[model samples]
Target: MKTPIIMIAMLSLSAPALAGGDMPVKTSTEVAYQDLNLATAQGQKKLSDRIDIAARRVCKLDNSITGTRIRDRDAERCYVAAKERANQQFAAVVEQHAKGG
Candidate 1:
């Protein structure tokens, strides 16, 4: 039996793009929940927390000293989008598991 993994990613305009440059960056991280039982609310909550942390890291919103005033807003946007995407992936994984996949 293989363990399930969730992928979290942020693909945004990036700091350079916010600074009037035409470049973008993509950052990604993985959350492994093989030890978690997604069928329970507690397990789901733990996975959600992990997703939040991963999203912050992917969007560079985890460190206060690494962003500027203008970039702060964009980072927030990136974090929201990244978390949404991660949630979608999580849902899919859960559904697949329920189907015995």
Candidate 2:
């Protein structure tokens, strides 16, 4: 009986880690996209415009850094960097919107 109680206590203590249950973590892009999806037509248009701007900026910067003569390795690096930035931006927008900002 004591052993079972101790095991139960330990399991309870570790439940969160084991279960991996937490907030529904979403990337900024996911948030933005979700907003875009749920928005009115005008709102969606605005979000799409912002998304396009961001994409263009990312593309321009990546191309400039890697140059027109980019090798596969260089392209991969640029892609990863741009993707990280996009994710961060998207997450921020999502968080902000979630807070009703």
Lowest-lDDT window of 10 residues in candidate 2?
Answer: 2-11
lDDT of 1 by residue, 17-96 (tens): 76986667677889999888888888889999999988888888856754554447777898988888889989987787
Candidates' TM-scores? 0.78, 0.35
Give the Å shift of residue 15 in candidate 2. 52
TM-score of model number 2: 0.35
Which candidate number has the best TM-score? Answer: 1
Q: For candidate 1, give the lDDT of residue 101.
A: 70
For 1-101, candidate 2 gives per-residue lDDT tens digits of: 11100000001112344479754322222213543532256754565456544544433433453355653443344445545565555455545655665
Q: lDDT per prediction?
A: 0.82, 0.41
> What are the C-alpha RMSDs, in order, of all predicted structures?
3.2, 17.9
Output the TM-score of candidate 1.
0.78
